[model samples]
Target: MTVTTDIAQRQERRERLVLDHFADETRQDFDAVLATFAHPRYELIPGGEVLDGRDPVHAYYLQTRRAFPDQRHEIIKLRHTEDAVIVEFWLLGTHRGPLNGLPPTGNAFRCRMIALFIFEGETLVCERVYFDSLTMIRQLLAGVSPEALPQVLSGLLEKVPAQTPAVA
Candidate 1:
């Protein structure tokens, strides 16, 4: 095969791997998702969180899923690079469980995000995700009055579970 053909083949393999990973995640098949990676790793940009290795990555998955049981991604675009596949997607989910001590708002959120699937040859290495945390937070807190803002924030800071959500 010519050099160009070899490069094309590698790109196709990488794309397949990425699509498979996303499918597994959508299916909530964590084990299958883990198997797609050479090493399970994630970099959550907004939170400055780095979860590396199988255990940490697995925990991260569990935590996020608990917070948003119906979480799923809608792919907007995919661009292949020499060392990464950049994906633009919409992450949609309903808040259904506690997140960082804050009770579920029962609100749904749709946030646009970008993730770079870094690779080594055909082996998936890491997924670095970028999104605005505030966008999701704002959507989750849609109908709170300006006068109640302080109380709402204070309650969150105190880790108090509000009986009613400030959902839209």
Candidate 2:
């Protein structure tokens, strides 16, 4: 096979593996989800958190799955370069469990995310992700009574940082 074909195959496989991992997480298949990672060196960015090994990654998935039990991730775009694959997607779910310390609101939420995967051979070694935090927070607080919407809005407006960086 040509070098280009080989790279394409590897990139496709890596994307499949990562998407499968997300599907498994939605189904609460923690073991299947955790097995997709490489090893202790695997790193996931965007959240600014590093998972030392499979165990920590597994824990992270557990918490996330529990919080968004109905979550489904849709891959809207995928592009493969020399040594990495970039995926743009949307995470759709309902807030049925605690998320970022917020109680369940049962409100549906949709958040766009982009992940860049760095590959070593056929395995993914690192992933950098970007998503909208404000949307997540809004959905999490949607369960408040109608009378409390103004209060929530006021709080969020007041909490907005002075120097909010614009997302690219």
Candidate 3:
């Protein structure tokens, strides 16, 4: 194949891998999701969570999905960089279980997220996510009124600086 054709084919394969990851996640097919990665890893930016290796990444998937069993992504835009695919997506899910020691309030949340599907050549190495933590937190917390949201967010933001959690 020509160099240009080879590059295009590589991009196609990379994009397919990412889309299959999304599909497996939406299906909650954890094992299938795990298969898509050459190096299983995730970084939840707002939550300061980093899970690397198959076991930890599996546990991280379990924990988060346990909290939001219906969690799924809607791809809004996807652009390829030299080493990563930048995805702007909507993450939607309902609070169906305890999250971070808080009981579920049955409320749902929809948040826009930007994530990098990082790769070493054609092999996916990481999925790093960025989003507003406070918005999701507020939706999960019962009795958080629209009027009270600012105060609620401010309180959480204040506490954020105190804890630097190390993810396995």
Candidate 4:
């Protein structure tokens, strides 16, 4: 195959892998989602959390699913770069279980996110995500005005300094 065609094929595979990972996550298929990673790892930029390896990643998934049983994403865009597939998406879910010492409010949240599906060649090594943490806190808290979000988030953030930021 020509160099151009080979590169295109690689990009296609990476794109497919990213989509498959998202699908698996939405389905809550742990094994399939884990299979997408050649070297599984996640980075939560604003949340300042890092989880590597299958065990930790699985636990993170469980913790999140407990809090938001219907957590899923709606992709807005996907950009394939030389080293990563960047995705812009909206995460939607309802608070069903305890999260960060906060009881379930039965409130729902839809937060926009941008994530980098970092890779080594075609092997996905990490999925690093960035999003507004305050939006989620305010949303889950129910009817909390944006005016008071800073004070509310400041106190809550300290309590949950290491929430696994999800948007893969």
Candidate 5:
């Protein structure tokens, strides 16, 4: 086989793997999702969190899914590069469980996200995801009742740092 042909074949395989990974996540089939990863890693950019092994990654998945049981993605675009497949997508979910010390809001959020599916040869190594946390947070608290606003606001403030960075 020619070099160009081999490159094309590799690209096809990566795309297939990425699609299967998304499908498995949407299905909440954790085992299947883990199988797709070479070492099972995730980098949540917004939260500055790195889950870099099977156990930690698995636990992270469980925690997030518990909070948003119906979480799923809608792919907007997929672009392949030499070492990564960058995906633009919408992450949709309903807040049904406690998240970050806050009680369930029962609100649905659809946040646009971008993820870089980094690969090692033909195997996926890490999924580095980027999104605005505030967008999801606002959506989750949008339906809060007037009576609950104070309590909800208080909970949110607890999660925020007391000191704010000065403008450069």
Candidate 6:
């Protein structure tokens, strides 16, 4: 096969791997989820804490699984380049466990997200993610504390630093 075809095939596999990780996370399949990442430096960008290694990634997944027991990601688009894949997606779920210290409200929520996956050969080395903060706040507020929505939204934005380091 030509180099171009090989690159395309690798890109497609990388994209599928990313989607599988999200799906496994949503399903509470922690082991399956953790296999997709590279060791010692598997990084998730755009707000979620950076995990240094496989163990940390596993720990983070445990926490998230506890928080979002019913979460599921729906992919809207997948675009590939030679070294990266861009994914546009939406997450839908019910808040049934603790999330960022917020108590569960059992409220259903939806949020849109976009992520760029950087691949090193067939493995994903990093993921840079973007999502709508406003939508997330709205969903988290559903049936709980509408009056405090403004404050919650403000806090969310404040947590995002003014300057985010670029993903390599």
- Candidate that beats the other on TM-score, 3 or 4, i.e. the better one: 4
Q: Sorted by lDDT, highest first, which candidate order results?
A: 5, 4, 1, 3, 6, 2
Pairs clashing within candidate 5: none
lDDT of 1 by residue, 1-168 (tens): 999999989888988988989999989899999998988988877766677899999997898899999999999999999999999999999999877655677889999999999998888889999999899889877875688777667766675333332111
Q: Give candidate 6's TM-score.
A: 0.78
TM-score of each: 0.87, 0.76, 0.83, 0.86, 0.88, 0.78
* Residue ranges of candidate 2 with Cα displaced over 4 Å: 40-47, 143-168
The most accurate candidate by lDDT is 5
lDDT, model 3, position 50: 77
**Model 3 TM-score, all chains together:** 0.83
The TM-score ranking, best first, is 5, 1, 4, 3, 6, 2
Q: Tens-digit lDDT track for model 3 on 94-134?
A: 98876655556688888889989999998898998999987
Cα lDDT tens digits for candidate 5, 1-168: 999999999989999999999999999999999999979988877766677899999997898899999999999999999999999999999999977667899999999999999998998989999999999988999978889988877876676533432111
Cα lDDT tens digits, model 2, 59-107, are 7777777778778888898888877788899988887786544556788
The segments of candidate 5 whose C-alpha lies over 4 angstroms from its true place after superposition are 146-150, 153-168
Model 3, stretches more than 4 Å misplaced? Answer: 142-168
Per-model CA lDDT versus the true structure? 0.86, 0.71, 0.83, 0.87, 0.88, 0.71
Clashing pairs in 6: none
TM-score of 4: 0.86
1 or 4: which has the higher lDDT?
4
* Candidate 5 root-mean-square deviation in Å: 4.0
Count of backbone collisions within predicted model 2: 0
lDDT value for candidate 4? 0.87
Tens digits of per-residue lDDT for model 6, 27-139:
78878876776653444444544666678777776776676777788889999887788889887878778665566667788888887777788877776677776687567
